[model samples]
Target chain A: MSNCIDFYFDYSSPYGYLACERIEAIAAKSGCTVVWHPILLGAVFKITGQKPLTESPLRGDYAVRDFSRSAREHQLEYQHPAQFPIGAIAASRASLWLRDNSDPQLRAKTADFIHAIYRAYFSAGQDITDATVIAAVAGSLDIDSEALLLAIATQAVKDSLRIEIEQAISAGVFGSPTMIVNNEPFWGHDRLEQMERWISSGGW
Target chain B: MSNCIDFYFDYSSPYGYLACERIEAIAAKSGCTVVWHPILLGAVFKITGQKPLTESPLRGDYAVRDFSRSAREHQLEYQHPAQFPIGAIAASRASLWLRDNSDPQLRAKTADFIHAIYRAYFSAGQDITDATVIAAVAGSLDIDSEALLLAIATQAVKDSLRIEIEQAISAGVFGSPTMIVNNEPFWGHDRLEQMERWISSGGW
Candidate 1:
């Protein structure tokens, strides 16, 4: 019964990016803190037997359309990245690295790194799979760029991400933007309203 | 574009059942007519390579929980049917039969039939795969029970359903409760708000 919302997301996910934009506000409204967990959907999909939204047959097209439509609905700026469904390992590991930093101020910037990295990929259409681009995005936020690049490449940071993905799968998360509130899992960006309701009402 | 919302749903889908409860009201708010297309998800799943929500590994459990949570969110009565993810072929054909009926009154009850069948399956916990159960639900709605049953049994009615399903697939419908407004497809009950916004504003 902790006052926390576990926000599980993959950096390559459009819906995950959309959720990142609003999840904080939703969490704050309910007096709850959000714990952002960036996991590789590629690994999770292996277990779930699911494909990326933009790669699935009929759903791929619909997903692309819905991504932009949903962004507009949320009043957020969105551009479909030319290189979508990219390997988000660098960005995800960077997020974990920031969170694991010993300095409190650096650790607190994990959320900032997440938002910036997501914006770079989804809005600016940057290739986040590249460690250089990830470092640049981190540097833009005043985080130590060299430290981030070095950290993400380390065995510890990579294993942290791997372990996190395994933990996410064990937690019954099969998709992006899954918010766990009070042990109840809500999947997808569309479920945010329902999650908010669950938070406000303390579980119906 | 036509001022119609094409609602494609499968009876076995819980989200489809949830969408059935609110789609008419959503359509009416935008001064649009609802054209209900009952299609088989089993057939769609063959093309999409999807398993039913209650049958998928991790998602199966979450979907079962979300079914009741979503129903409660909409203030609709719901019970997890003991027999879930039942083959909805009988109910699908029944709906098509009602829609194709020569009698204007019988044809007009297509929406009623959809709602009743969904409620019978999801709320009343009845085995909707049973044609007798579908007939009983339709009979309770003042629809002609014997004639409806006989109509669904015909090869013509079955082919009508097949054609409609094919048409639905052709229209890019790969999941239940897909509402196509202005040729823009919106999938899932979760997308209703976005779809309503699309209808009200005529797309972004």
Candidate 2:
């Protein structure tokens, strides 16, 4: 009755951040291991017909209420990213570089980074294009800030993040924080408990 | 730390029917009591500016895919209901009538009645406007079909259903199967685990 949970993530997704925040506790409770799988949201959206905030019809008036209900229900804080579709390339790259050699607890740390970045972008209307905030988020998790910057700059990490994006596309992942446990995919933060229960129950 | 859970429902909402199926199981697990609420979808759409299905941009189309994934993850069977948006006045009235006979474990039976009606509309694509199916559904529930239908016609059950709707509106019930523990509302079936946890932690 053992399995590994691969959590697909993107820094720009507040929902992804929400899953990162608490999925580990659930995983622990359900007796499963967590793996961090960072993918490019931009790529996933290209094929999924998923549009950024400004492009979605319900955005200007309804999205705020829509997401607020979901976020508040999940007990995660959000305001709206200041910059629409903030370039997540660097954030993804840093996340990739910090993989394996860094903490596998990346699940929890990544959740934190997603929240801080969402707050930075949507609520305060800050520039997520700045490497400083990204680095600060990494630093807050005790991961090396300077190293994260270097990692973001390295072509290897950059290309790796790009590959992760490609991988998400090839694997049919269309959303953030898609918890893939035992090769079963649960697409939203709302599906987290279902994934854990799937694992806990040995995939039924 | 006890609070009433006001469940807002549109008898025509497939999602509401879906949520109703396992709601009491969820409530028992979460230690919450559900106040069965029935609101007219036609009325809600009029006030909230939520468009009717034919006008709402097929947002629900893609949602079926997501819900399919969720259902699979949860190990639940989700055959899309047959008939949707059936004339729910009778069913809603009947549910209000059943409230007087509250049984802690009867939600599943209640859900069956709701599901049968949804099937009458969506899957069968029948005119749920048919009195026969409505009578059949109520009869199947082991409820007195003549009495229930008579109650719907007499304004007795209709008035009770209206009061439940007003109660839900006053309690800020925005959606169905909403779990309110200690007056804090958690809308959607997905939040059942958190609702349970919130209760276990004494409303945190």
Candidate 3:
């Protein structure tokens, strides 16, 4: 219905952070807006009977290796966080709060918040599971730190994230870094190239 | 130790078939031999506590869609087999049988046999769970159908397939179409490009 691409991700996901780094530019090239939806993949995993790729034995080791390799290949800043698989409740809630409060002057602020959260977890190797860390990241962006910390605990922000997760599940999204263009789901950061081709060619 | 890429795959994987269609060309360009190993992912799943991608609700739906999209993207033929998740035991054993019988002229025949089996399972939509069907596929490839059928049934071929599965598991293989080069594992057909880059640059 809208001329926007749905980019679903979880703040704790390395692949999600990778997608966020490149998605906006990729979407802009196709003249589409990216609607970022930060959701809890742990909840989705429970429903899909799936576990994090980094939790499975061999895949866990391979994912850690690939995460850094992919970052190097893409020329992005990356470092595996010390406290991985951290709860992203604060970050997810803060992202929604920023989006809900967006004004003409603050239209780009939402993206800044998303990127800052990702950077904290991925690039800086900071433990982002704490609300204080999320608030600090927001505060660095000139946003009200105390207000963000308060907003993340608000019922509205929490419900908004829950609704986003539910919508993602209903949309057949079972993984983080899932991009949906014109309602077709392309799962994983690896499919970004294919998604770009689909957007440019209008489905080949 | 050899100038070869260890390509581990299961016959029932559409992505594996996609990899088979292009792996040889990719490997040839790198001046590397692709040593194909057909192992039962079902066995690996037992150890990893994983299930088929197609068995995970929304992911299952996404995988089927991605399979065809990937096929079209690669200019390869693909059809989701009617016998979804068909047993790959027969095909795995047949592949081992062909490798064991490889002579100077038959050195390349093993790959041919593997490709034919993939074609039967994916493009032809044939039920490859049956040893007879695998033998028939090999027969069409100018391989000895009767001998191939007999070979698949032999204890040697069965044990070889089991050993390959054990080796794959020991080598940290947890999914279909896992490419291992220089002791590094690159999982999925999606990583083919990354793997090629790794091969070309000899690691970054």
Candidate 4:
């Protein structure tokens, strides 16, 4: 009976960053809550037979251009990362650590961590694959930096992400910034408007 | 220099059909003309390592739903063709045949033929892979059916489509509904808004 939307994203996706920037406002307007699921897109790609949009030949060039243009259009600061499509395992595990804490304050901290990571990768052009960078981001977010890094390296945390990724793939998520509402999947950040309309109308 | 937008599409692309339904109006409002270039997406796919979107695993299901929902959002009548991602060789060749003819009036008829084929394949759910069906769609636009069929079968027409496909690929056109303005590429029907804004602002 909850009017909650499940948002799936990979840390390295520019559009995922863009979607993260907007989804909260769209949900707030409709009195809905979003449950964020940060997963490794590489796992999803294994099942979908897709590569990173920026690695797909001609689309790679267009994607690079559109990433900047779309960010500007949305009035969000963006600079292409030096190490793009970086391995986001650390970031994803960091998010899971925050989400699993069950402390409401720490739960709020999850958003801060996710947003900072996105900004670090996209706006500041940082390499998020480095555990030191991720720990620094969490430290800036007022979370325990050393603790977060240790948690991200734990076997339990790694397995948690692996299991959830398998579940996400089986649940039909093959792309970043895919939203699931009432069991219907909506893919792409551009679809936020349609998703808003669907939420408002309870779907057609 | 003409302020014309080069529109590239594949007949089997639902997004391409959706774009065909809208691009002319968007251009007319901006005092820009649209030059339609219908090419085989398969050729682009060869370079990009992408298959028909509907053939992808989890993404395939989402695409079908998005196609219908997006169509309704635009108030365009849409019925998915029974044979999707169909062999569009006949349709593309037919379009080139119409385009290659030097008569200005016949060139104008090309739009009529293109729209009809889109409607036949998408709205009417007709199998446009059939040469007879393509000729029939052309016939609806007052083109001679038998002559159209014969023209679509010509080696020149087939070769003409091949050269354009190569040209589109070389031009970095990797997807359907790609719009090129001032030599910058904009991909997707979703980017039509951005395309309009680009035309209005004459590029950022």
Tens digit per residue, CA lDDT, model 4, A1-204: 437989999998999999999989998998889888998898788778999999889899989988888888889998988877777988999898898886777778987788999999898877888888898898887898898888878999999899878888888898889888888788888888878888888777
Tens-digit lDDT track for model 4 on B1-204?
438999999998999999999999998988888888998888788888998998888888888988998899889989988777776888888888888787676777988888998998899888888877887787778888798788878899889999998899889999889999889788899888888888887766
lDDT of 1 by residue, A1-204 (tens): 448999999988999999999999988888999998999888877777878777777888888878888899889989999987788888888899888888998999989889999999899988988878887888888988998888878999889999999899999999998999888999999989888888888777
**Candidate lDDT values, in order:** 0.87, 0.64, 0.85, 0.87
Q: Is candidate 2 or candidate 4 better by DockQ?
A: 4
Give all TM-scores, in the order shown. 0.95, 0.63, 0.95, 0.94
DockQ of candidate 4 against the true complex: 0.69
Instruction: Locate the minimum summed-lDDT window of 10 residues in model 4 chain A.
Output: A99-108
Q: Tens digits of per-residue lDDT for model 2 on A1-204?
A: 665777887767766766777777888898777777877677765554456644533222334544565566667666776555656777667666766445576534654565566566655667767888888777777777886788678787778877887776665567777877665667677777676666776765
Best by DockQ: 3
Q: Please report the interface RMSD of model 4 to 1 decimal.
A: 1.4
Give lDDT tens digits, candidate 1, residues B30-144. Answer: 8989998999888888888877777677888788888888888889998888877678888889899888889899898888888988888888888888878987988888988
Among all candidates shown, the one with the greatest lDDT: 1
> Candidate 4: global Cα-lDDT?
0.87
Error of 1 at B164 (Å): 0.5
CAPRI classification of candidate 4: medium
